[model samples]
Target: MFLAAMARPRYNSAGECTFDGKIGVWPYVEWVAAQKESKNRKRGTMELKPSTSVGKEKSREYLIKYVLPAIKEKWPEEDRWNTIFIQQDNAKTHVDVDDPYVLREARRGGWDIRMIFQPPNSPDTNGLDLGWFNSIQAMFQRKMPKDLPDIVKKVEESLEEYPHQRLNRIFLSHQACMREIIKHKGSIHYALPHLKKQSLEATGDLAIRLDIDLEYVEAARVFLATP
Candidate 1:
């Protein structure tokens, strides 16, 4: 599987995109040189092989080596010193937020990077899982990748080519989903909301965040307070 990190796209004062929000996407594979010549290839040809082990060690390695550095390099300079939260689902392979090595690496360069999990049992709250992955997958499938290396290359291309504005729209949709979750008393059974985002964008009325009714906030508070 490919691992990815992204954030809501950022725009400057004149509304030009400053950051595209694609920290990076990394495939969980390594190149292994063939030991013996085969009909398909000569000996010593390096071939892409999917990782056999994907546990906490591998996950932490990806975060420390790839994700963190990408964020450091690509994150906006103005906000680099501010707290940056890396959100991941509560998969068993995911490192704990407080893993010592992770904490040390996250604290490097005086950047306040931190890790957090998505809301429990609410995978839809993640912008990637909510919409961006689907967008990337759609684009990647259109490329008709023919092999493992091709798949990786196509996926990375898809991610790079994906529009930043569409990504921002997906993040807004994520906020809308969170609002719905609160309105539904933390339930995930509700239908996904549609905002006609493309039309809204054309009209220049697309919102960075959806407004929530005060009553909904109160109701969610009450629900949280209940036994």
Candidate 2:
């Protein structure tokens, strides 16, 4: 999305926030603004944190604080029986799974929180890269954000408005893609399979977890062992 450091929300022609208006500014952790605001928010506002760059340092802050907490709260209880692996793209900005702060905080609640890096060159396996961005882009384009706060607010709203069922289907698609990649010896050159997920979901026949074929797993393991 909008990762620029500064954006001006529309104001009167004179450009003053005469109405106590909003501006689009990305402050770092409010890091320099530290200890001033609660962990939930920065020092002075009620909105969610301002939209910032998905940089390495920032990703660490968010993973430990924001994303982890949200997952803990909403994750299904049955799913908590084992370690929770939060897989993200291997972006340089994302923190390593063993970063001391990540390790320390991750263990605090007796939660086995961990990060997973996807295999490189396998964009087909990422649900976000596949279709979710299209959904987000469409939603974002529909909104006319006037300022930074409005922009952030609108983006958050769009995320909320995105269909959860669509996301579930994306996960299933990801699994399918992974299986395909394995069959191709990890090559990412195949077309993504269309599962008619929506139709299956509507008919109460869609499966949340797709079974991985043993051959694909064996194939992947064999390929990995070679190098």
Candidate 3:
């Protein structure tokens, strides 16, 4: 199973807030189970669960309770015996430097599991992130819930009814895309145009400016060192 963590802002519709409105954070934990085939082919299941919390601590607790257990239940029996690798990005909620629950679980499982962290700013590397937001958006479009309780109920219903086969098709497609990316030596930019476009569109204004400034500062340091 490949796992990825993402966050989307929660809004209060009764208060007439924007989609980006912050009623605290709703962190989503997505799990995809893939079965490999010959010649780099693969297909599998996908499960998405939204975990709510007013703060980071509560969020982590929610993941431990609701998300991880579901993942454990769905884990392939053979893979559990073999080396199980859990891949996730370096989100603060996902993995706190001081104490990461996933890592802790891996240790408790007698090192039967391994945790891999993707490179910074590399959401495309994880296929779960690719179609996750679209699924959430589709759910949101169906019914704009009045309050948190309504939103939670709607989200639960969506997850329970989400088609696993469709998710498998998506992962198989992503596996093919990944193979091509590997052929080009992991240059994600060249492999997936749609992912790049989605990533760019998702980036916020302040984040873009900060990234540009950071690049400039790093380049200036390199020039100084050369002199």
| Best-fitting candidate, scored by lDDT | 1
What is the TM-score of candidate 2?
Answer: 0.67
- lDDT (0 to 1) per candidate: 0.74, 0.51, 0.41
Q: State the weakest 10-residue window (summed lDDT) of model 1.
A: 218-227
Error of 2 at 97 (Å): 2.5
User: Which regions of candidate 3 fall more than 4 Å away from where they truly are?
Assistant: 1-60, 96-101, 109-111, 191-227
Q: Give the per-residue lDDT digits (tens) of candidate 3, residues 128-196.
A: 455554676787787687754566566555544544433333343344455566777776665453434
Cand. 3 TM to true fold: 0.53
Superposed by TM-score, candidate 1 places the C-alpha of residue 178 at a distance from the truth, in angstroms, of 1.1
TM-score of each: 0.87, 0.67, 0.53
**In model 1, which runs have C-alpha deviations exceeding 4 angstroms?**
140-143, 208-227
170 in model 3: Cα distance from truth in Å?
2.1
Local accuracy of candidate 2 as per-residue lDDT tens digits, 110-180? 77766566687777644455554575567668766676567566655554555545655555676678778
